[model samples]
Target: MSEKINVGDKAPDFELIKPDGSTFRLQNQLKETNVVLYFYPKDNTPGCTKQACEFRDQYEVFKEHEAEVVGISADSSDSHDEFERSHRLPFVLLSDTGNKVRNLFGVPRKFGIIPGRVTYVIDKDGIVRYIFNSMTKPLEHVKNALEVLKNIEKK
Candidate 1:
């Protein structure tokens, strides 16, 4: 895998399919708001579910900070739909079926088996302000992202 992107790097842009079968482009989102982009291994799995739920629970906090949270995985749009419905996830869940976006972000694999879990806080100008990469501490992704966004909002 390529070296993990740094905090100040420009975020790689990608187009992904949303659970609703519509397409979402990272650049388009950046035009309006800062983005909290997270890459997870799969949908409905244990760790992934906890991470998603944490994001769902703190989604209002994210919005109040003027940031939008988006979760991505290699699952198909159909799977994302079911996962979103089951979890009542308010933010967008995108399908990166081929791991294209995952690779674009250079998210490493944990134990060389599952995709690495990483969260990125991208400012409105499309520059990444922070990256938290951890396969085990899923909920920290939400906490770290909120902290970064709160700082960004203050500046």
Candidate 2:
């Protein structure tokens, strides 16, 4: 794992493949809005499903705060596509097949086995304002991210 970043640290830049086979660059998205970039273990799993659905349901709230919620996983583009479509997720799901972005953010694995479930709240200036790491409380990810974005907007 790479060095863990702090709250005020500049978020590392990365590019990953989206569900449609297009590239998603972090720098470009950060230019317009804050990003709720979440790294999950897999697609269609129970915890991941609940997490994604929570993000989907609260997606409009994120948009109201001028934040973009994005999910990243090592799942392939086809799996991502199916997951998005099946779940009716309103946000973008990136295919981080190489786990490069996960390592870039130093998201640790659970028990040195499963991939970590981490959520990062990054501002438009590319600073990481908050990070929530939890393997069980999946719904809390959406709630915490919204809270952080609201606080950031107040500043």
Candidate 3:
């Protein structure tokens, strides 16, 4: 429940362990391209699976726009690895086991058990230009954010 950010705010820097045993630093990775960072609840579950698969479906478009997609969840690295493998996801899945990263991003949730669906579109300059939060229909968020990024670049 941190309300510390709004549009045009500098995106906070973070470093988390990726499922591949590599570390991801926000500022470093996003120095060139826009970032589509989505926080989901669990892997392999129906909602989460659909959302992830949708991202996978549009991976090439995100790449075409020079944007990188990353997913964060409270699940373990092992779980993330399994999910990635099962889904053939072509992007990074970071593990935030302690929920510290989620808290840092101020992702809303319920009962602290399920993660609220939130997507942040960070521009190349590391600023949060757009944020989309939806309680349901999380799978549509990637398309929404992608459209926003496209419109922003058109400007």
Candidate 4:
């Protein structure tokens, strides 16, 4: 794996495909708002569903703070589309094929198999403000990201 991106490091810019097949560039997004970039394992899974719903539930609050919630997974665009429509997820879900972007962010695998559950809070300037990595406590990612976005807003 590449060197893990830390709190103070600049978030690496990457391009991925959204469920609608539109391209999503990280740097381009940072120009408009802070990004809550999350990498989950799969679509329609138990833990991933809960985490996405949590973000969906608090999405307006994130928007109030000028942050955008984005989810990434190795799943295909079709799967992401279904997940979003099924749960009514308001944020964007990008398809990270081959785990390229996940590797770019250095998200580790749990026990060398499952993809890591990690959330990164990147400020408007593209600096990573916070990183929460926890495979077991998936719901905590949303809470922690909101807290970080709040702190970033205060600054």
What tens-digit string does per-residue lDDT give for candidate 1 at 1-155? 55668899999888877776688999999999999999999999999999999999999999899899999988888898899999999999888778888888889988887888999999999999999999889999999999898889888
lDDT (Cα, tens digit) per residue for candidate 2, span 97-142:
8888999999999999899999999999999999999999999999
Give the per-residue lDDT digits (tens) of candidate 4, residues 6-33. Answer: 9999999999878777889999999999
The C-alpha TM-scores of every prediction are 0.96, 0.98, 0.94, 0.98
Model 1 poorest ten-residue lDDT run: 14-23
Candidate 4 residue pairs that clash: none
1-155 per-residue lDDT for model 3 (tens digits): 45555678988889998877789999988877899999998889888899999999999999988899999998899999999999999999998888887888788887766787788999989889888888678777988988988986897
Deviation in angstroms for 46 in model 3? 0.6
Which is superior by TM-score, 1 or 4? 4
Name the runs in model 3 displaced over 4 angstroms: none
| Reference-based lDDT, each prediction | 0.91, 0.93, 0.87, 0.93
Model 1 clash pairs are none
